[model samples]
Target: MTFKEAAYFILKREKRPMTAREIVEIALKEKLIKTSSKSPDRDLAIQIYDDIRLNGENSPFVKVGRGLFGLREFYEQKREETVGEVQHLIRRLEETQYRSNSPSEFEEVLKEAFSFLGFETELKGEPGNTDVVLKAKIGRDESYTVNVDGKTSRSGKISDVQIDWLSLEDHREKTKANFIVVVGPDFSKGNVEKRAQKSGVVLLKVKDLIELLKEHARYPFNLLELKRLFETPGNADYVVEEIIRSHRDRTNFLENLKLIVEEMENLQSLLGYFSVDSLVARTELGPQMIKSVIDLLNSPLIKAVEEVSEGKYVLVIPKRELSKLFGRLASACEQEKEQKEQDDVKNKLVKNELTKDELIKYLSRTERVPTVLREILLPLCLKHGVVSREMIKEELVVRKMAQNLGQAGLVLSTVSKAIGENELLESIISYDKLKPWKKDNFRLKEEYKEMVHAVIEELKGKEQPKTDLKNRLVEYLSRTERVPTVLREILFPLCLKYDVVSREMVKKELVLRKMAKDLGQAGLVLSTVSAVIGRDELLGAIIMYDKPKPWKKDNFRLKEEYKGLVQEVIEELKEIKGNLQHGT
Candidate 1:
């Protein structure tokens, strides 16, 4: 018999977990198998692992621990307890979906899905009221409810003939739901789909809903953001795709950040500075971000990147501690992961987790911006166009999310993450933090204000929430001019002399000019001042120059694409320098 066969025999007899080595030895001694293979234990372990992973539940072999194995039958005897879990409800759904008359059970499953999706649900009478009422809280005060109806078919297909369209509307009116949804296994082509579209009811397929739930478990959506799905009309597939896109973006971000933190910490450079471009080119993991995006990471919350000169930056925390800090920050910036369960169902997702040690080890390396925070700040950011750390902190505290200053500060730490989320829409159109080194004011680029307002318009749909209209933000873009001393005194002199500036250069200038009180604050204000004059983009080009210390590069390389934007801005900046020289 083969080693795998022998192991099955040995395991059945042992009735306990055994390491691959122990199993191989027992099989050989008993003469259950003969192997000429040099590493029989290794071979057996691979076979067992492949069998379990490949065959899934069908595989008799079960992994016990590192290099250990157990029988599936052994564990099946002792089932684990759960806390009103969604997985079991889904399985129950699978069973109920096939039965023609089990509409009630299907309704129950849909209710479970709503709960799992973090909605406040109520299951009511079938003939009279809607099957389910789903209330979702958008912010601390804003909330809206959805009407849900489940359709079941023995043939696993639902046609318009099977549903009461007028009755569904009646249920919607009676229930007073902001929106109505009809969910079923399948729908008839012409009438069912046409009526759903014509009447504005969402016909959500069971399989599609299940897929959304699985994706939700993997990358839990902020309830406020998830509400976007209900507000959107048309196929349920659209909602599924929306959630899928969000999940992919977040997963990509976490992994990239982890990489940067780990890589920068490794250098441990004496000067403790590196170019962003060279770093991205070498690591091949940097996301497409503007230079001022540096300000986000440089914020008090993350403190991951410190932009010293034009395009140079240093990691504030080393690799070992960075991983731990990320774990804590990711947990703090968690986006509504409370109701979702971490399950590994064969076809389902394994839930988005940022705490894994290998940095997860550098995935979301840059920042961990929670979706909830993005939702909270969306309208506020759009209206003001210029915000302070205090304003953001006050918003979070008033939202009743974080209690007091400390908790509010924890929530605010994810502001770097917020920058990331909004930046994906349009890099320059989003936040350009002017003072990341301090808890101070920052503004958006004036040129991109209109485009940003359009993006904001898209996020906030036609249907307005019924919450109090207290925060009716202004229609016009607003920013009082802010020209800090660092912009004129410290940064300009160095910028004129050097194509590529170092953190050291700016620090010395700050000390010489007596613009900053101390070296510590001087270091903080380096690239920060340039961000105000919108020269941060030039620094992005310079970021690519560093190729590690041995081949250390100091020359500023302006990338082809950024050349035009940089030249135009530099001309305007030179005018600023001229004004300074003229004492006007």
Candidate 2:
């Protein structure tokens, strides 16, 4: 474990500041400060501590107050604290010797000490309060927002002087949240400890913070644990060291490391959607944006993966998360590959099977193929030219023949050829042209006559309805001059359910329903419904559908009397207006 790692572990586990002695104890217990056989009783842990403290100022580990060291820079940066201010405070702490006991009334010293630790200090926020808060991110794939009250204590509990506060429940509700740091020398009684235990919030004290700084110099925790130690600088070093040792089984560690790496890479890729560079470099993006990306990469939700390439990473994760992410990626790649193949086919068809003039003149007019299917073939068309088009047609015919053995291929020619015979021979000039014909006897029995006949009949009786309501409607429409609005309320739903309604049907229905006086008014009513209401009601009354519950909200059905009443009112109003105008 590095200094940052040690500091992180302390914060996460102990939830308090740690003393140099306490940190040394933890290091010995965990065997973090290694000793050679020749130097068995030489206090290797203290040596590590001294080294950390010597260069602790402005280093990864920083002294918070007297005898308390913490990974201040790590937490401060995690919480987006001012680097310069933190450096200044650390400098001040190095020079000024404050009492080892309780911090004094001299606010400047307190402010400087906070500054040294990189706390965003606000004086007299709403008055009568001196609150110090520590904020930082923790977690692999989650935003573990921790807040610590800045205070120190002999009881090894966080202080009640909350620099920031949020309920524990709120914190827990967060995708990954831990604590709200209450920064002080000590808490009222065991309030800090109780809350911390109950809410799973860390409590850091001044001394604990100091020791963390010391630990960070030798063996530092990752961003997450480092943040927690600073949040509540208690005797966190021991707790964190124990955690590291207990969990440092080689197999588990390697597995976790792999998982973290993979997750971090995935996170980086997600961030790349916004055009962010890798954590290792400054992209073209602004500094703040880059910082945010780095923050995201280091978040608990995103585990740090090993770098595979420049701006490329593999995630460090277990099989489950990896499986899901890989599955999605694999699916997307397959879809893209499939689409590419389809496009290649189409392009080949265009390039080989059709002449440039033919493609330009007639390809735009072709609409039988769906856009998705055309996309598939576009590349093929581009590649093989006219030959690919023939291939596409042959494939389609083959598929159809496969499905139905008796199926015959359609005359695969343009509209121009169907309408004008001379253009067909001219447009298609090749040795292949004579293959389908036998000179003057080229006129084969028209196979498409049945399809054409069906189309003609369909057009002739387009408005014919199987229901008797249609005939009665037509007769009533012939008698009526004006449409009654009441009929629309009923007809709209019917049109929607049975896709058999038309403009003539609407007019006829109005008369059949006794809602119109004459056919002219029915026509006018149909026109009014089509034009003013924008063809909504007369055509169909379909409730906009959504998944699972299409009819959840909308209820469009109109009662018969209510419809009649509304129409009657409109008629009465019109009559009244006409009479008043005449009288005037």
Task: Note each model's CA RMSD in angstroms.
Answer: 31.8, 34.2
For model 1, how does the per-residue alpha-carbon lDDT over 227-285 read when each residue is reduced to its tens digit?
76677655677777777787777666655665665556554364467666755765775
Q: Give the TM-score of candidate 2.
A: 0.21
TM-score of each: 0.42, 0.21
* Tens-digit lDDT track of model 2 for 217-284: 32434555445343443335466455355434422433343343443455656763222344324223
- What is the C-alpha local distance difference test score of each model? 0.58, 0.39
Clashes of each: 16, 133
lDDT score of residue 155 within candidate 1: 82
Model 1 residue 127 CA deviation (Å) reads 3.4
The candidate scoring highest on TM-score is: 1
